[model samples]
Target: MNQDFVNNLYDIKGKVAIVTGATGALGKAAAWGFAYAGAKVMLTARTQSKLEALYDEMKAQGLECAYQIGDPIIESDVDHVVAATVKEFGGVDILLCAAGMNNPKPILEQPTEEWEAIMDANIKGTWLYCKKVGQVLKEQARGGKVILVSSTRGKLGMKNYTAYSPSKAAIDLMAKSLACEWGEYGINVNAIGPTVFRSDLTEWMFTDDTARTKFLTRIPIGRLGEPEDYVGVCNFLASSASNFITGTTIYVDGGYLAG
Candidate 1:
């Protein structure tokens, strides 16, 4: 391939990326990945200390980045984050909604409030960010990327994922619906569904135990995922390389979904 073609592929330099759930494991991975790839990143989350800490860490690396405090479920908070990103970075070219929660419990044991909380965090939060950030991309009239986080649970049913599974399933559809709705505006909306990644929530899966051993049997690759495994995929989705790809969940599950 020519140099121009090679350079254009996966090129995200100078683009502005807003990463929600900036304090979470995937959030940190995406934020740093984008920044390291030369995109100006705006980190947003509900916790100020964590936001500042992340911002500081990135700043120390000499990466162009800023932070905003916001809750994905709150409209005003989402609005401020969008506004703050534009103010800090001039304009947003990508959005990675990594803000989500999961409280796995049996259907009979799950409370209404807890279920609603999961919905609010995973579903509503994703919708709110897409709605607000989409407006900006529409106005700019520049094609943009929207990366929503889903899980393998979104497609496969798990015993105790009463609320979490449905919430993620909704996200998969939301990405498709938004992709169709915003295609006219040149905005690409897609979801990334990972299977049992190493994170604060899935840390126990890394231990040598029956649960870990049992789970490994399901993965064809015979391994758990790590935060680093996400960097390339996130970069692909955020960069111009994926301009024509949308409305689908790219499963980063080490062939678990293939089985």
Candidate 2:
């Protein structure tokens, strides 16, 4: 393999990226990775303190990055973020929709309020980001990338995850729908479906040895996902390496779906 050519295929130098839900484990990891790859990454989340912390971390590493305040469901906030990013970094080349939530409760125990919360955070929020940022990408007319963070539960349902399962399942179509509409604009929309990853979100599930064991047993790779497990894929998806790829969900599971 020609090393230089291979590197060029994945190069993200001078690109601009916006990562929502960037304070979360996967989002933060992805933001850092993109910044490290020489892209100016803009991080967005509800918590300014967390965003600042991540900004400081990037600065210390001499990577190009910044953070902005945003709520996925709020159109004004999404507009603000896109405007702010364009003002600072020129335009968006990659949009990573990593903001999502899940409250695993059986259908009988799942209240309407919980279901709404899940939809608001995972579905509505993601679409807002995609729609707003997608417009920016389209105007640029330079082709762009959108990576939505999905989950294995979206593909294969599980008990006690009523709202979450359906919410993520929505992302599958959302990505495809956006891809079809935006393909002519040269914008690629795709998603990542990770399984049983250990993050702040999954901490409680892993705390119980029995529960953790049961989850791990499902992965043929015999391991749970770490934060690092997501970076390479996010980086690839955000870079030119995946230029021809769109409207597909890449499973980052440890062979969980295979089984």
Runs off by more than 4 Å, candidate 1: none
Local distance difference test scores for all models? 0.93, 0.90
Which stretches of model 2 miss by more than 4 angstroms?
1-5, 205-207
Per-model TM-score versus the true fold: 0.98, 0.96
Cα RMSD of all models vs. native, in order, equals 1.0, 1.5
Model 1: what TM-score? 0.98
Question: Candidate 2 lDDT, tens digit per residue, 101-217?
Answer: 888888898889988999999999999998888888888889999999999989987889889888888999899999899999989899999987778768887788888788877
User: Per-residue lDDT of 121-162 in model 1, one digit per residue for the tens?
Assistant: 999999999999999999999889999999999999999998
- Cα-lDDT of candidate 2: 0.90
Model 1: which residue pairs collide?
A: none
lDDT of 2 at 55: 90
